[model samples]
Target: MQNKNIIITGTSRGIGYEMALQFANAGYNVLAISRKTPQILIEHENITCLPIDISDENQLQQVNEFISKTLKKVDVLIHNAGSLLHKNFTEITTQEFQNIYKVNVFAVAELTKICIPFMEKGSHVVTISSMGGIQGSMKFAGLSAYSSSKGAVITLSELLAEEYKENGIAFNVLALGSVNTEMLQEAFPGYEAPLSAKEMADYIYNFALTGNKYYNGKVLQVSSTTP
Candidate 1:
């Protein structure tokens, strides 16, 4: 893991923040991207924080420029950024749904495309998804847009894995259960989650490092509780 380079999105806080810290602490060069620059990460010697809206095409080009000048290759790319819309299907507008999909699904695909040229055979692309995205696992009300967007990404990962298999690049999704995140609090008020952000980040950290060796084009349900 020494001198390895990793690019992670959604690092303003929660699991994404922890991932940036974990990877940088392990001597890996970390490029942490978020809408707002993460204060804690900017001071780290191994971390370079980029503030950009992943959903915006113009801002996404900045990621390409950064990589072109900064790193030789990308060893790991984790699409940890997500957008959640907690609204009833009846109340959801087309624009509202598009916003969620833009962040969750479209951004993942576009960003992966940008990073592909930098990725080699052993590189891994880990996308963070929701358990609610799984077809038969369980369903929740007021998550039509959010859950559906997550589901789209799951399938996207599967196809990317197959398409990139010949290149030796791996694509996988982690469908997570309830976690005590700011986004979760907004959707389910006062609902205590069994897992903490740091704990989940710990699991994902190890998984991103080694899961690709055993699994590719697979969705691992990292949930111990029902939503």
Candidate 2:
């Protein structure tokens, strides 16, 4: 599996970080990107850490160059980096909204665009969204910006699945439930999640490897409860 290259973003911690460890242990060359290098991932021989803030245009360009030079082909691309602004809908500033979208949607799109040339047939793109973004779910207050950005990710993945089907590339979205992560703690203080980061990482890793064979243009909500 050393020949297989997987790029995972927001790997400084949480689900993304756990996914990097799982992929590295499975012998895949893991390209881990985040705003800062996580201490655990730095010592892995199969993991390459890129300290990149995806919201920054300049840093994103650097990521494009670095990955292009380092890997000949991309087998899987996981867009897990995200931003959440817990504020009332009326209080969200334009810049804050943009920042949230930058990481949750725009960065995913830009990075995927750059990585597509390196992705051959059978490559899979898995985007991480949130249950809050899906329609018909119980909506919550103070999540307007974050939820909307995730909603865009769902549609974007669907569109990409159609546009790139000819190339044998598949796109899918995982509308994740609340997981035990720093992001979750920050967004919902003192709340406990049924799913741990490692558990979610395990599920995502397996899906990333073989999900295209079973699914395409699908938004699968993964939650323990119907919040």
The alpha-carbon root-mean-square deviation between model 1 and the true structure, to one decimal in Å, is 1.0
Instruction: Report the error of model 1 at residue 139, Å.
Output: 0.6
Segments of candidate 1 deviating more than 4 angstroms = none
Cα lDDT tens digits for candidate 1, 17-116: 9999999999999999999876779999999999999999889999899888988689999999988888889999999989999899999989998999
**How well is each residue in 104-143 modelled by candidate 2, as lDDT tens digits?**
9889999999899988899999999999999888888999
- Model 2 scores a C-alpha lDDT of 0.92
Write out the backbone clash pairs for model 2.
none
TM-score of each: 0.98, 0.98
For each candidate, the alpha-carbon lDDT, in order, equals 0.93, 0.92
Q: Which 10-residue span in candidate 2 carries the lowest summed lDDT?
A: 63-72
Judge candidate 1 at residue 131 and give its lDDT: 97
Error of 1 at 191 (Å): 0.9
